[model samples]
Target: MAFFCQTDSYATELLTEVVSCSPAQLKTENGGKKETLSGYNVILKDTVLFPEGGGQPDDRGLIGEVPVHRVTRQGPEAVHFVSSLLDPGSEVLVKVDWNRRFDHMQQHSGQHLITAIADSLYGYKTTSWELGRQRSFIELDTPTMTTEQAEAIEQLVNQKIRQRVPVIVRVITTDDPEFNQVRSRGLPDDHAGPVRIIDIEGVDANMCCGTHVANLSDLQVIKILGTEKGKKNKTNLIFLAGERVLKYAARSYSVEKSLTALLKNGPEEHIEAVEKLQKSVKTLQKNNLTLLRDLAVLTAQSFKNSPDRSKIFSLHRKEGDNEFMNIIANEIGTEDTIVFLTVGDEKTSGLFLLAGPPEIIDQVGPRAAKILDGKGAGKKGRFQGKANKMSQRGEVESLLQGVLNGTAPKEE
Candidate 1:
């Protein structure tokens, strides 16, 4: 059935009677699972709420004190989902959420203006458009759009808005000759009856059923955010209209102020200051790495001269890495020596490294990793892996010692 909002877009509240009310169930998918929701489906004799259709969201509001959570069109009826059932043939007061309705109207009308201008000036036909909560986008048939072309279209659209052009809505039969002139995505297969056309003064005339403002000036402003490459060689033009544009501008200003204070520079100097700081940090990191390598060499030299150095060596460093442990093992220079190293702090999982003769590594490497509940692979004589059970470092050391003493099981 035809809705009152199709013609009287400014109405917010209606005194109507309920034609039918029945218990209803809606099925929806959540996290890859299907679920059913129980509610009452109410049909009103007249309503101001716009049902979900034409890429626009449904209008939400209260119906005689009970909240209407969702409104959708099924066949010829506008189905309102309510928590409780309303009495059939009972008189009711239906109110639409004006803020949400106006926002949708602004975005929908702005999209029509943009789509019309793009086609008239550049021959880029609009394939689709989406009216989002914070922003909207129109997909063009072209593969790409240059910055200059987008700016020019934005300028032209704003100029039309400044003209305060009248936005006229008219219902015409499908047989009317002017119907062919109206730019439309095309009527639905099941659509019948009189077609509604929106005429923007001398600018555009298009077939649309969505609510729109009475004048172009009601859009306040239209700001083109940018464009992105869409599926199948199409360009999606991102834009914000009316109140959304103001909200975006305010958010950008807040971020700029925060950056200016944190960087100790003006807005224009932020990039240069950040680049210089990054270069300085890189230089310091390089120096720190050189010191770590030198420390590893000195530590290995001290261990090399130890009189108690055995065929199998077991050591644990409070805060060392696999690279440091490997360097130390390589410096030992004894072909028969084996090194079992665990390095980390009390707060972290730490790492384990086993470097030694090929025969010993092949036999005990996988066993050592199993004790630590980790995994590793060995090549030549080195094996390394992360040990998530840091407190079990002592257990790993003891297992390696058993292999050295020939007490551990041999790999058969």
Candidate 2:
């Protein structure tokens, strides 16, 4: 059935009777997250709220005093999911979210314009389209479009908008001659209403059930942002229409201003400035790694040169990484002294490594890692893996100490 929206896209409010109301399971969005809800499924005699269909989304509005979060098509009825139940025989004000309604209207009709123009000029049939939150895209059967071709298409679309072409909806039955004339992908098996043909005056007409603007001028302007690769070797033509174009322009200018301040350069030179900054960052990182290596060597030497010459060495660096830890372990000589090296926050997650004799590393490495709430693997007397709780390093030190003292416990 053709809902009120398909018939009059501009109508924002209607006084309608609640035909039926029943308890049902529902989903409502809270702060952009969906939650399962227990609510009333209200069937209104008539509604301005459009159900989600035809690649367009459902409408959000009010049914009397209750907020209608969801509306869906069930056969010929538009089901309004609401928090409060309205009496079956009572009349209620069904108000459409006009801003959202008009935005969808603009994009849905804008799609028609794009589809018609693309097909007429390049014989590129629109396979499908999506009305995304940020931008909309229509997938064309063609593989690609050149810069010149895309420009020509966008030029023609805006030209038609400038011409202020009237967009008229025609309702026709199966027996009507125009029924066979309009372009259609095909109708649903359950489609029960007269076919809708949206005619863009002197442009084109196609069979569609979605809501649209009354005129091309209502679209304001359509900006074909660019094209992207699509599945099946098709091309998706991305675009923004009406207020979206204005919004995008405003956001882009804002970003440019912020970049100019942060980069200390005009928009024209921002790219070069960013490139130079990136190169400088890379050089600094290289120098930092070299310093870490030098520190690792000196630390290992401190252990070797000490009078005690400790057999079990334990070290943790909050700023170091796996590479730094490995360098220290390698310099200490894994043949005799057992080295336990960790790099990261002492009380949180980080990497760990163990180095010692073949038999000792096999036994102590995995045990030490487990004690530190971690895991590891060993080969040629070297074992390393990640640890979640670096706070247990002391327990691991005691375990290694027991091994050095020949008092380690037997494997379980």
Candidate 3:
């Protein structure tokens, strides 16, 4: 059955009766997974809302006061998914989201025009197309596109829009004589109604089921933003049409304004300013690393000079890394005194290193790994890795003390 939106793309509201509302079992997501659902599948007697079909998203609107989030076609009927149940045979007002509907119409029609022109003018058949949230892409049966070819195509596509070419819709049985002449991309396996032929007068005739603008003028404009390499044997042409192009311009200008204010420069100098800022950041990072090394050496020297230093030493630093821990371990000379060092948030996770006698290193490494909820490996009296529970540093200290007192137990 031809949906009301497909026949009358401009209609935004319709009065309809509910045919059936059944409890939903599951909904299909990406990867063919069916998740448990919490909604009812409603079938309207007639609907103005469009179901997701032919590379177009389903229309969003309302069935009475309840919002209809999604609509899909099961065979010939448009199944509307709604949260609240509506009684069968009861009348309800169906409303279509006009902005979304018209946007889809503009992009779908614009894609048809581009596909038709590209195939006829350049012999690049459109293998597929996408209706993206920001920009749409048309995948053509070619390896690459040049700047000159892109400019020429954009110019010609807009010329037709300027000429206000009429977009006519014809619904006919599949066996009609005219059906054989139109550019058909094939119909759905469950298609039950007449085939639709969207005719752009004097330009092209394409078999499409999605909603479309009444004329090329309704598209407002078509901007070929750029092209990208698609699959091994194809190229994708990226473009935005109608309100999307306007939205793109608005967002670009807003970003430009913010950048100009932050960089203290005009749009022309923003790129150069950003480059200079990045260079300065690199210099500061180099200077900071040098300071951290100096601080690590001084910290180790302070521990070595203390007269009352214990054989087992523990230290924690908030803003140090693995390199800093290794430097302190080397400076303090951990052959005789066992050292426990950590760098990160005291209450969270960070890097840990234990460097001391080989016997204790072997015994305590596995125990530390379990306590810290992390993993590590070492040889020649050095064990280090990430520790998720740096907050459990006390438990690690107790285990190391057990090694010092010769009371550490052997695991079976």
Candidate 4:
């Protein structure tokens, strides 16, 4: 069995013959405008565009102008899968996006440093990971950690970054006891081939298929962006690596600057400014209630002064909320009088009616309902109903006057 290092693994071998490509090549993809590439399965070449059984994304570029859609390892063979048809023995140029490759390297390397720090300092291990397009996250075995503990790990990662320790990738056979002795996020039992171990001297070691930086310094930074509660005893952590950290910082600063202008406050006063605004809103709500109460009293007095007084009377008004109707009815309600009020906007209406003895609410209540296009049942003289529209107020007032004077029939 042979063991390959990280540096040598990237180089492609000369292909004397072509074996296969995926159906994707024929369709044209990977930013290519072409139609397809030949060979479906076995690109029997020592050089490979396929990213093997690693969890990392496949390498994408061109295999002689044909897009290499994907790369997967089958058993012991390396396959060069392409997206467009290609002729056998065709001599073609291969291009790989080194920038993308290096970005993956930085992220993978950062994961190792952080994982090692967590395991060494707190006995927590990374259980799983999701490498997304815009962001990436790792799940840890423990559900939660104190901010102090996480900060310590973060500090350790920075220390390692500054130290610039070398990162080594080597393959060891299952038969090797040294491989079993390593404490890592262990590999799957089904992975029977040579076990690839990533070792950072005096820092951390793990089994991984993803690419990584040659040294810790290449990572630049490993920032844990945030954490969220995961399964029973795990927590998920979001992180940024290398150039992403720089990008995140730039974007965050821009947001802060814009917020400062909108809020009319400096960073130190932002929180205070927001809190003050909330307090002002509450004060305005309280003051509004006081004003409504005063207005309702004045309106009720005007109704009492009118010569068209009836045994049952109601006033329809529009105001902020249902509170206004209740206030008006209660202010005019006396032992022998019933005053009903309905208040609302075009959207909806609310009713409040009060009765006092000589309180013939029962006799007049139903009449009020009929006039308002609403229904309510009560004895004596008190009744209330929601009118369909504001225009119904006049009809409602006229019906109450007729019922009180005995000039109109009450039952219907």
Instruction: Report the number of the highest-lDDT candidate.
Output: 3
In candidate 1 the C-alpha lDDT for residue 97 amounts to 95
> Tell me, what's the RMSD of every candidate?
5.2, 2.8, 3.4, 10.9
Q: Write the per-residue lDDT of candidate 3 for residues 1-412, one digit (tens) a residue.
A: 7888888999999999999999985465756775766899999988999999888888999998899878988898999998898999999999999999899999999999999889878899998899997899999999988989898889999999999999999888888999888997788887886898899999999898899999999999999999999997899999999999999999999999999999999999999999999999999988888899999999899999999999987999998899999999999998898989999989889989999999879878878978898899998888999989988999899888887887766566
47-127: candidate 2 lDDT, tens digit per residue: 999998888899999987799978988878889888887899998999999999899999999999999999999999999
- Prediction 1 TM-score vs. true: 0.74
* TM-scores vs. true structure, each candidate: 0.74, 0.89, 0.87, 0.60
What does candidate 4's lDDT look like per residue over 205-264, in tens digits? 676766677788988988887788888779887788898899889998998899799998
The better-scoring model by TM-score among 1 and 4 is 1
Off by over 4 Å in 1: 20-38, 278-412
Ranking, lDDT, top scorer first: 3, 2, 1, 4
Q: Which residue pairs show collisions in model 3?
A: none
* Per-residue error (Å), model 4, residue 169: 1.6
Candidate 1's residue-wise lDDT over 248-360, tens digit each?
A: 99999999899899999999998998899899999987876677678778877877888886776766777577787888888875378888878886335778888888887
Candidate 2 least-lDDT 10 residues: 185-194
The C-alpha local distance difference test score for the whole of candidate 2 amounts to 0.90
What is each predicted model's overall lDDT from 0 to 1? 0.86, 0.90, 0.91, 0.67
Cα miss at 236, model 4 (Å)?
1.8
Against the true structure, whose TM-score is highest?
A: 2
